[model samples]
Every structure is written in structure tokens, then in C-alpha cells.
Target: MSLDYEEFNALFTQFERTAIHLEMRDSYGTAIELPHMAKWATGEPDDLAWLQDWCDLVREGTQAGKSFRRAHVIGEPLSDYQRWSHSIMQPHIDAGSEVRWVPRRLVSSIAFPGNDFWLFDDRLVVFHNYAGNGQIIDFVTSTEPADLRLCKAAFDAVWPLGIPHEQYKLD
Candidate 1:
């Protein structure tokens, strides 16, 4: 099923055990992030106040014994968007979710699904479909055993190769 924003938001807290996200894009045009990215491009400072809601959610989840982890399969010489994303990740890290970076070059042999996804408790997969320019097209959810297995295995293959956010530095 295609999920609206509210439904997608609910999945974060709805999952029972783990919420793991796999991000494959080098850039994204999320509306909320454009303004922040622009501010970053001009070298302006942002207090990142807008991220508080997500931070709170992650904090709450972690305290409840749930795990939130994300793996970004990023390209080398990070794009402007990725660089800015990396800079803003500290707050999320502090809030409780663990962020890791995996260089794209290192994962050429692994078979990944066609889109980005969040695998929840190894049961449901929420696929994030984006247009070529990185604008979100829609959010799709799937629970088929094959789909779940692909997502789980893909994430597993990539996770071990990730460099924790603290140790991943831009060149």
C-alpha cells in the first residue's frame, strides 16, 4: 500500500523491535530540507530546531529498548547535500539513532532493491520512491516474505561495512 506522510511517520514508533533505514541516494530534495540546505550552501548557521520532533521520537524509541539504525551508501567526494546531511547527523546520533556511512564503491557486488527503504522489525518494508531529481514520488509499504528477506539481507550485508558516523570523515 502507498502510505501518506502520517502513516509513514507512525511506522517509526509502531515497530516493535528495530527500525533500520537504507539510504542509497547522494542527494534528495525533501521540501523541509531545501531551506536548511540553502542555509548550509551560504555558510549560514542553523540551530536545527526543526529536527526536534524526530530527535524526540528517536530518543523515546531508544529508551524503550528499540533500536534505530541507518546506513547511507554514499558516493565518495560527498555531494553538497550529503555533506550537509553529514553535518546535521550529530543531533540524530545524540538523540539515539545510530548512523553509519557505507561507500558506494564497496557495495557493487551486493544486490539492492530499486529504491530506498526502512525495514521495520524484519517484517515490513517501506520503500521510498524518488524522482530522478531526488524529489519524493511516494512511500510504499510491503510485507511479502521475499520483499522482507531482500531488505533484511541487503541491510545486513551493508551494515557491517559501515563506518560509524563519528569516524566517517569527508575528504
Candidate 2:
């Protein structure tokens, strides 16, 4: 089924064991991040206030024995948005989310599902759809056997191939 933004964020607070997110896009058209993105363009250290809620959720979940992992598959010559996202992702990592970077070229052999997804506890899968220009479109959540298998297989194939956040450098 489809989920609105609030419903999407609510999953973080409810998953029983793990939250695995696979991000395939380099940019997100976010109004909430506009000022921060602009500041980043000028080489400023963007404020962390905007991210507090998510970070808190991650921190609390992890502290409660949940594992939160995110793998980002990005292309060469990172876009400005990628750089911004990389910088911002650290806070989530610090809050106990295991984040990794996988350069896209090396993973061509594996089949991708075209959209980004969040797999919760190996059960529910939420696919994130976006416009060509990076605008948020909608999210589809699934618990079908076939979909879970595909998502789990795809994620397992890519997760180990990713470099830890600290070791990955955008170039």
C-alpha cells in the first residue's frame, strides 16, 4: 500500500529488529533542506536541528537493540546533493546507524529494483518513488513473499560490497 510522509517516518519507531535502507538516488528535492543545501554550497557547516528527530529515532532504536543499516549506491563524480547527503549521513551513523557507500559501477551485475527501499526486520518493504527531477512522489509498502525475497537478495548482494562511511570519500 501507499504511505504518506508521516506514515513512512513512523516505521522507524516500530520495527522490531532491523531497518535496512537502500538509497539509489543522488539527490532529493526537499524543501526542508533547501537552506541547508544552499549553505553547504557556500562551504558552511549546516545546522543539525533539521535532522534531530530522525537521529533520535535511530539512536533510540539502536540503543534498544535494533540494528539500523543504510547502503547508498552512487555513481562516479558525485553530485552536489550527494556530497551534502554524505556530510549529513554522519550524524545518523554517529547515532548508531550503520551506513555504507557502494560505488555504482561495481554493482552492474546485480539487478536493481529501480527505486529506493526500506526493509523493516526482513518483513515489510517500503519502496520510495521520486520524480526525474528528484521530487518526492510516493511510497509503496509490501510484505509479499516474492518482493521480500527480491529485496532481501538484492540488499544482501550489495551490503557487503559497500565501504564503511568513514572510509568512503566522494570524488
Candidate 3:
């Protein structure tokens, strides 16, 4: 089912054990992110003060014994957005979310879900639908056993292949 923003954000706080995100896109055009990305492109420094909300959520979740992990299946010679994302990742890492990067070529053998997603506790999945221009269209959530299995398996298969954020370098 499709989820509104509030409903989607609620899942982040409500998950009991873990939250796993698998990002397959090399770029995104999130409206809120454009300004930050533009600053990066111009070589301007970012205080990253805007990320406080998410950092706080991750900090609280980890302190509560919940785990958050994200794996990005990215191509070599990263897109501008991904490069900027990597440069500004220290705060999220410091906030307790474990982020990793997987080279796309290494995952050619494993099948992946059609869209990027977050799997909460290996049970619920929130798929992010995007337009061709990388603008988010909507979020779709699923609780079907098949979907759960697919997402869980996909993430598991990708996780071990990822290079930790600190070690990953732009190509």
C-alpha cells in the first residue's frame, strides 16, 4: 500500500529491532536535498546542521538497542549526488547508523527488488518509487511474506560485499 510522509516516517521510529535500507540509485532529486547538494557542487562547506533530525533519530534508536544499517549499491565513478553523499556521511556514521557502499558490478549475480527499500526488522518493506529524473513519486509499503523474504535476502546478500563508509573512496 502507498504511505503518506507521516506514515512512512513513523515506521522509522516504530520498528522494534532493526532498520535496513538498500539504496540502488546513483542519484536522487529530493527537493529538500537539492540545496545542500548544490552547495557541495560549488565546493562550499556545509555545517550539516540540517541533518540533526535524522541524526537524533538514529542516536536515540541505537541507544534504545535498535540497529540501523544501509547499503548503497553504487557504480564506480560515483554520480555527483553520491559523491556529495559520501563526503557528508561522517555525521550519520557518528550518529550510529552503519553505512556501506557496494560496487554495482559485484552484485550482478544476485537478484534485487525493483525499487530502493527499507526493511524493518525483516518484516515490513517500504519501497521508494522514483521518477526518471530521480524525484520521489511515492512510498509503497509491504508486509507480504514473499516481499519480506526477497528484501531480506537481497540486503543480506549485499551487506557482506559492502565497503564501510570510512574506507570507501570515490572513483
lDDT of each: 0.96, 0.89, 0.95
Per-residue CA lDDT of model 3 for 1-171, tens digit only, reads 999888999998999999999999999999889999999999898899999999999999999999999999998889888998999899999999999999999999998999999999988999999999989999999999999999999999999999999999776
Which candidate's TM-score is highest?
1
| Candidate 1 runs further than 4 Å off | none
Looking at candidate 3, the ten consecutive residues that score lowest on lDDT are: 75-84
Which is superior by lDDT, 2 or 3? 3
Per-candidate TM-scores read 0.99, 0.95, 0.98
Best by lDDT: 1
Candidate 1 RMSD to the correct structure: 0.6
Question: lDDT (0-100) at residue 122 of candidate 1?
Answer: 94
Runs of candidate 3 with Cα error greater than 4 angstroms are: none
Assess the local accuracy of residue 88 in candidate 3 as a C-alpha lDDT between 0 and 100.
87
Clashes by residue pair, model 3: none
Residue 29 lDDT, candidate 1, scale 0-100: 97
Model 2 alpha-carbon drift over 4 Å, by segment: none
Query: Would you list the rank order by lDDT, best first?
Result: 1, 3, 2
